[model samples]
Target: MTTEITIELDINGRSETLTLDPRVTLLDALREHLGLTGTKKGCDQGQCGACTVHVDGARVLSCLTLAAQAAGRPVTTIEGLSAPGGELHPVQAAFLEHDAFQCGYCTPGQIMSAVACIREGHAGSDEEIREYMAGNLCRCGAYPHIVAAVRQAAEMAS
Candidate 1:
């Protein structure tokens, strides 16, 4: 018989208890089990940053992170970035102002990473922003605009 473990996760400031197989990834737990689908799954091997989410304020790959491993930790998905009053996060706003996305498939990951990039103090220069955001792939060639958005958001934060 397969063993199922019940774990409680703090997601978006809410407590969610799930009973699932240990193999279930945090992506599946958020998208499949909890109905929070903002965190996309791409290049499930972790090469692409599409499945990025913040665990305890640090970004991580949900695709490779087992749900159980996140138990007792705070998980913030794309949906959690917005304020309860419906205001967009600074990075989200900057992306809109800069038109930093095209197909939008990678925008969530990019935004998530950009937030971390700014918070981590790595958005000082264009080169630094590019280096910090290298992990996120934007097939639409929105790198220039993305860098601009990150730059703007970083400036706003400072």
Candidate 2:
């Protein structure tokens, strides 16, 4: 049986309504239903931060979030970080400047979490930022550059 639930989502800057299966995860809904594939699915069990996104301006693991539960909340994915005109967000720019990503598989989630880390005042120091950003792993062992990028983005944001 298919249960259609209508959810109002503030995706990026636009408001949208979608009818979806209640069992669908926010990650799946975003990628499969809405075609927002920027949020990658790594572990899918929430262990990996590859599925990170912003919900109501806070970082969350999209793979673990229920689409129905996110109704009426603002969702921001990596694609949304850039303005419609194609200007990169400060964090995105910093990532490039620091060469924070190698394989690029985890870059989206890392950037998303980094944005939240700065916004939440957790990026105060290199050690502190590294500790806070520990959740998002970079298999390429780019932690140093990742930390630098986060610091750069934080400085730029300030």
What clash count goes with each model? 0, 0
TM-score of each: 0.98, 0.95
The lowest-lDDT stretch of 10 consecutive residues in candidate 1 is 36-45
**Best TM-score goes to which candidate?**
1
lDDT of each: 0.95, 0.92
Model 2 per-residue lDDT at 94: 94
RMSD after CA superposition, every candidate: 0.7, 1.2
Top candidate, metric lDDT: 1
Q: What is the Cα-based lDDT of residue 103 in candidate 2? A: 94
lDDT of 2 at 37: 91
lDDT of 2 by residue, 1-158 (tens): 89688888788877878888889999998899889999999999988799999999999999999998888888999999997899999999999999999999999999999999999999989999989998898888999999999998998888
Q: Scored by Cα lDDT, where does model 1 land?
A: 0.95
